[model samples]
Target chain A: MQPLEKTGNILPLLHEIRHALEDLLATGQTMVIDLQAMPFAPSELVELKEILGVGEVSAELHALGKSTIQETAFSGAWWIVHFNIDEKMISQTIEICHIPAILMAQHADIQMGLQQLSSTLGGVSL
Target chain B: MNQLSLEERLRLHGVSRRGFLKFCAATASLMALSPAMIPRIAAALENAKRPSVIWLSFQECTGCTESITRSHSPSLESLIFDAISLDYHHTLQVASGDAAEHAREQAMKDNWGKYILVVDGSIPLGNKGFSTIAGISNVDMLIETAKGAAAIVAVGSCAAFGGLPKANPNPTGAVSIDMIIKDKPIINVPGCPPIPVVMTGVLAHFLTFGTLPELDHLKRPKAFYGQNIHDRCYRRPFYERGQFAETFDDEGAKKGWCLFKLGCKGPTTYNACATTKWNGGVSFPIESGHGCLGCSEPNFWDAGSFYAPLSTPIGHVAQNAGYALAAGALAGAAIGFANKQKSSQAIEKHEEITVNDLIKGETK
Candidate 1:
């Protein structure tokens, strides 16, 4: 199949996403762009990223294996990549929001950290 | 009576202010309100007095109540519903017999011209014996209850468009709420059982703005029913490219092509099922492999068979074809003769080229 036709024409989908992203930005709402729903070759994925460009903010999440998050040039848009235990690609998506939810520490995890810190401080001098 | 404010009730439910704000933001987005309106929505819902709601059930299957109550346990939608002063709901309230009738009367009297009147099912005007609440006929009860309403909400297809109870016969003479209540502002949220969030969303809008949200010609909220199902369908690309599934188990069906040829009524039907989805945004009928029944529209029962393709003429297939056939024959013969003469001339003028002529190109 031609490289253009291999992806089953995601340009229309991209147009829709762009419009939705604009609406999300305007409304302060978060939206998830599910890449799994579309058939995009590696080259097409790279092309999509290039078209969207990249911003300055990026983060690495180390909880359940390693996941990388990158922000696009668009004000509130982001790209997140998750990997399996074997470092194989698990899932990828373009998330539009003021900040992606993956980087935030859960309340339970924060409580655990607080408990550990207070117990250690109680034993130590300072 | 539940006297606590919405914010106080939410706090009692263990929902934080931030969580409540998030719910407000989500509600605003769903209603297509601006982000600037988020804070306003939060403020309104927070301190808003719980409006009394009198739910009247007539000729319904209890599906609308079921749909609105299908939210998760301790869900924001459920909490919002809990925040409302639902004074009388025959299906959910514990009162029975004369007590239920008294409760409805007391609610309407207490909150005269202030409470929201929610009606489900169609009103039968054929005979007073057709349907009744206590001893009052459905039509009489509706007319009496709707008199002092701030606004009437017609939930489900029955209340909005005289559904199955009013199908094709003249027996019951069932009619919608809008057909009877001409003085009051009626907001129709028509669906087989409307999306739960939509019901709550409309309530939120009214609570926030103190007025009904924008509605379409059918009195359905345009925010939820603005776009046609086909336009928002996931398999729309297949329709645009002329790919369709002829049968249930065909290759096109297996490949998840469009269901238009399989009697999908998505093109004309307008609803939010395709976008908002059903059962907690899981999947709608088309996604689960079935044609739309056009349940939200008026007189959908008489629309046609659910399995007949939209291209197929509904009532007079053979008669319409017979009429078209005679006209087509005359036009076909003339076109066929003209085509024969044109093709013969083209063939006579045709020239053959050798392999060397391919190198010579078109100029030669």
Candidate 2:
């Protein structure tokens, strides 16, 4: 069945992302939009992805689950989809930022790594 | 047993910051909060300690438990269920007989006045022998257990509102939790069997924020119950365009036109069915080519015919709409215009749906 256009949430979300991109440029702000918050008309999500297209940067993180981080065609817009160990998609989001926060190493993990390195080399820990 | 915060537990489980962020993002969405609040949810979750939950089941068919059990592992709902201390549950617990009672008593003693009490099924007040566990009446057990609870979560329509057992000719004199316990803060998760995500969402909110989420007049979480199904329905366009399916096997039905004429109660019923869906994102009743049974609302079984469309008079435009609105709302439904209307207001809002409307096949 075709969407009647009167009850469409996809276009409004695209507009919201555009506004978020502008906000990012003006104030150095970042934004995350939860794609699963609202129900989508069938195939609307696929249509959205097609519209955004794909960008060069795409990476996968293996933590408790497999998380795919890909930049959309729009430079600052990133699409991140996470799957549980069982391969179930837990969450999907669109983030507008310079670099998505999850891609960076956490400070606590870095500190622990540094301490382990110092102990391994018999050197003073910073 | 691990006296650690939720973050600490996830870290020990080898979950990284990224995984935790994914969890938070999913959780925020499930709780109907914006994605911007993920950081706050994460921060709050760092210090959030797991509270003990005591699940009490009575006068139930175990559909609520079945709904929760159907939830897959590692989903936020199942994850939170694992995170919390589910001290006593009759269906899942290993202990039985006196041993089971002992486990319940021990959990209550350990976390007295701080533990969460989750009760499913209605309480039969007429006959003490109507429903009992280990020679103890359901009402007695509920009253006794409620005394020390931090908050009470009435799960499913049976416990939240009087469900099937409390339908016409209700022999057991079954009444809801709110009717019995007025002292404690009760959060009603009403559905024939509530969506498992919503049940866990309430628990997640309590775990993260140390308080219950905002509730509507029916004591349901506004996040899930705030919008009626019609508003969120994909068939809404067909409904607004006045293109309705006249019969179950008609041309309009094949083309996926609105099912209002087929007695779909989507317009009157309020729940997260359209958005949350059921059986893990599979289609809901309306999507499956069936009218909503209005199961979540009170006295749904007695609210005229499920096959009868919500009647309206074509003669009076304003009068017919108000009458239709009040007819649904009178049963304590969250119909769009009059969810807050009093009984007197509902009576005043009522207008007649004459036989001529039916004769013309023009019921609204």
Candidate 3:
């Protein structure tokens, strides 16, 4: 049997993830996301967090209580986002469900805005 | 018209000629002075009158006194109490009650502006009632004693930087002698318990010169506190090569690599521990495979976690990564282009020369 191709376009999923990340960054709040049981590698999780403008990413080895994401996946695939201000973890399930194209565009715009802000404040590019 | 010889002078002070000369030699070596200075030291000491000194114990553990008392060679007790006229030390004085107070009072009255004052602890000022000795608050006692002192030597971290008790929250509001007595020239011999040799060296310098030695901004003698422990560290080569011990007994640690990753504070600590070492220059903490805790620097306790590595990005990774990649790519393209040019040139040269002409050239 032919391997089943991923049914939905990944661009829309990425856009949704990007919007959630932007909101989290702006508000400095923790967010829970569902990945819809899609399996992904560690590198994909790292790339997803980077693309979503998460600064420093660390992974936990255990599930946070009562979350919808599997304990193993949460421990293995969840990414902790770091900034000078704070650190927060993002669930792997949420990442897989929302890899949308508009999210990539928003990520670029946010990165550019961050660069401008850093340059203005520090008098040097970050 | 009779002046005693150097031997006679030393004998009058109860030091044998051999003992006096040996002490001169030791002093010369300790001060990093030329051997020729030994005779001068002997001569100076022979003619020199014993300087009056007043020992004050404030809010402290008496560890400084204990450390000094234990000096193995030419013990500090003999040097300060018997060798020089230590007029008053609350712990050492034979006088008691009113008599002890009278001795201090009389010493100050007679030697006003000439006696050396040695303080051994921080003065707690949070409340005037925090610490008292002999019915006098330490702050008030310190201020009163420091008034007529020719010079002040704060003998430990307690009297130098308020020490462990002043670490954080600082509820007692302890302060060093410099904070209270700004008018007098103060020399700080600071350590958990300062090196015995350092304590003697400062006193020797004063005894020989009748003044304080050159001091740093922190009022420390430059001779001992000038260089950072890392500058003279044996593991410095390992640090330079990026070899570090991840944990206490790990493989890297077994090989004696840098302890920086193990939370060594050598980088920021300035002290003579590495060079001078402890226990008569025998060994330092780093030599025994422990990272320096930077106990000598001010506010070291509050700096941060002691075991955390002073994290800095490794290599030129952040600065030259792009340049290196670009250079590699350019080098690859240049080599490809050169190979293409060489092959094309060979083809053109082969096409231009007939086989017969090539054979003719070889034959010729």
Worst 10 residues of 1 chain A by lDDT: A1-10
Off by over 4 Å in 1: A1-126, B1-4, B32-36, B319-364
- Worst-scoring 10-residue span by lDDT in model 3 chain B: B72-81
lDDT (Cα, tens digit) per residue for candidate 1, span B1-364:
3666776665565554544554554556556565457678877876777888999999889999999988745454655576678989999999999899899999999999999999999998888799987889999999999998999999999999998999988479999999999999999999998888788878878877778999999998988888788777777777888988899998788777788988899998888887567765557888787888888888888878888877777798798889899899989999999999999999999888676677645665
Candidate 3's residue-wise lDDT over B60-114, tens digit each? 8988888777643334224433445688999877989889988999999988999
How many times do residue backbones clash in model 1?
Answer: 0
State the lDDT at A91 in candidate 3: 18
Clashing pairs in 2: none
**What C-alpha lDDT values do all the predictions have?**
0.78, 0.86, 0.66
Candidate 2 chain B weakest lDDT stretch, 10 residues: B331-340
Off by over 4 Å in 3: A1-126, B1-9, B12-19, B34-36, B72-77, B311-364
Worst 10 residues of 3 chain A by lDDT: A81-90
Whole-structure CA lDDT of model 1: 0.78
What's the true lDDT of residue B14 in model 1? 57
Clashes of 2: 0
Clashes of each: 0, 0, 15
| All candidates: DockQ | 0.04, 0.41, 0.00
